[model samples]
Target: MKRQVKPIREGNSEPGTVSLFSIAGIKTLLQFLRLGKKSGALLSMAVATAIYTWFYQWEFALGVTVMVLVHELGHVAAARQKGIPVTAPFFIPFLGALIMMKRNPRDAATEAYIAMGGPLVGTIGAFVSFLIGLFTGHSLFYAIAYIGFTLNLINLLPIHPLDGGRIASSVTRWLWVAGAAGGLFAVIFLKSFLFFVLWALFVWDLFSKYIVHRGKAAEYSCWGKIEVPFDQIPGENWMLIPFSEREPLPYRTYSDMDGKQWVDINWEEADVVHPVKMQEQGLIRSVFSTKVERRWQQTPKVVVLRYQIDYEPHEIENYYEVPEKVRWRFGISYGALAIALFVLLDLVQLMMNEQGGFFHSLRK
Candidate 1:
């Protein structure tokens, strides 16, 4: 009983290895778990799942939660692929899931792609559900598929904060008026508090866009054709052009008395103001003066104090530079919109036949 036990060999026995449940191992495990943990996303999903489970059943709730997660993850994936920093998908009890991006897309195409990815992946998930229902003849699968289809389809409506609205906005700011109308229709016809929220969101978006556009217009007005007297032009032919919120840049002026064009000039440092040079080059034609004219005669023509410019020109309109990606985005957006409409109609008809309407089925 008093004999000493042999020491355990480190390499030959399991006791030498770290135990996952041991104190040190546990601390390491905790650190690993904390790394890249998306606590907010997990919490939101848990709360949403709990709400859905309470309203319906565990299976239905799980299915819906998975679908929304898949949809939002689609956006996250696309953004990441484009080198955009994005957050994990966060779920809302009834509103669905969303991903917070760190910054805006560089162009319309990037925005459209990011918006479309969610619906594209969500639609695939719905189709898979539909197939499962068809094969198994399970009504639960059908219900899940219906929810997926309708939710994604609704997101495609031309309303602000929706995928379709973002896509349309890239084409023209004027299209927001149409989006506002759609929001109004949702509020009036659906009579749902969700639509009311959407309408309010659209109104806020319009106001924000107006403020942004006004600021842009003011900035644009500062850089344009400025008619200065001939006397003001530097002898070295260097003119200082004023720009709003930016440093003045060197400009070259040409005068044409016959054409009555005093504002004929070109920007010497076009890159300083406009990177694309879309609206700056060819903005003014060449004009020159061969001689200076005497304006007054005093005490045998000794006075040389008056100079004048005959004409003033208005500011030339600024041109918007379309990125190369716009064409591709335009094509993809329309195609996606068409598909969304078709899916929406199909879901509506199916829901009507099954439960009188989409909302009615949801209630059931």
Candidate 2:
């Protein structure tokens, strides 16, 4: 005997059947995941916000997160302006947010320009917050403004990996000495063990770049002369070869185990007809010529090419080619920004104190 199954209800589907709404929801989720893959900024930012909210009040957490986002966007804008490729900002809960460069800046000036952008724009963001607090008389906005000013001010310390360190490359290396002293003071004042660790790292960087690698700095400077020997020339007719007739030479640039960079040209694979023509054209000659070997001068800050031709080594001091006028401009800007942040920090403190202190106002 066969048993009869219960009749399905009009509004209910079979057990195994999925609703149209579910399918649509799943498609939406998949699209969001794909977007996260392309740019993790939003997702990571959400995660950071969640973690910060867990530790502190949501208002403070959100404010700090937005401030950091503004700072990173400044860097992104500057990089774009300089035609440098960079990834979107990724946030770390306690640490901060950062953007990675796809390629290094070619010179100290470019690096400084990009570096200064973050603190410069970040200061503006904080100042805006300060104004909002003044208008609204809200302690929360004032508190955020104070924190923002402090963060940007700390970043102005001339230490490696810090914005000020890169800016100092175009200004003056002597600022690093000041950074060492300032970093120590920051560690003590803030009472942050993390900052102490950073200070230690900064000290080591100073020693490595300035003391240990002092001689090498001048020796491996960027700029070199390339020459093609007349003996290596295949024929006089090679020079007559049209530029379009010659195939492009393939080459790859990479860093060695010691972090020294090198450019390897595949001369064997290149069209032999192009070398002499490239030599006659000057600058294009190095990569096309079989007789040239290329080495890159690698430093903590910049990488520059050094070429060897026919066993002769030549060097050119073009790395720090930023004009004196530009250097003065960067110096003045850096100093003015720092002073402005300090003044804003004091103003925020005064306002908060009038409101019965930041903590008291927040509690109310």
Compose the digit string of candidate 2's lDDT tens values, residues 280-347. 11122233222332222322222111222211122235766789999999999999998988888888
Q: Each model's TM-score?
A: 0.56, 0.65
Give me candidate 2's TM-score against the actual structure: 0.65
Q: For model 2, which pairs clash?
A: none
Q: Candidate 1 regions off by >4 Å?
A: 1-36, 211-325, 328-332, 335-341, 344-364
In model 2, the worst 10-residue window by lDDT is: 274-283
The number of the candidate with the highest lDDT is 2
| Span of ten consecutive residues with least summed lDDT in model 1 | 302-311
lDDT of each: 0.58, 0.69
Residue 168 in candidate 2 has what lDDT?
90
Candidate No. with top TM-score: 2
Look at candidate 1 and give me any clashing residue pairs: 255-287
Which lDDT value does model 2 have at 213?
61
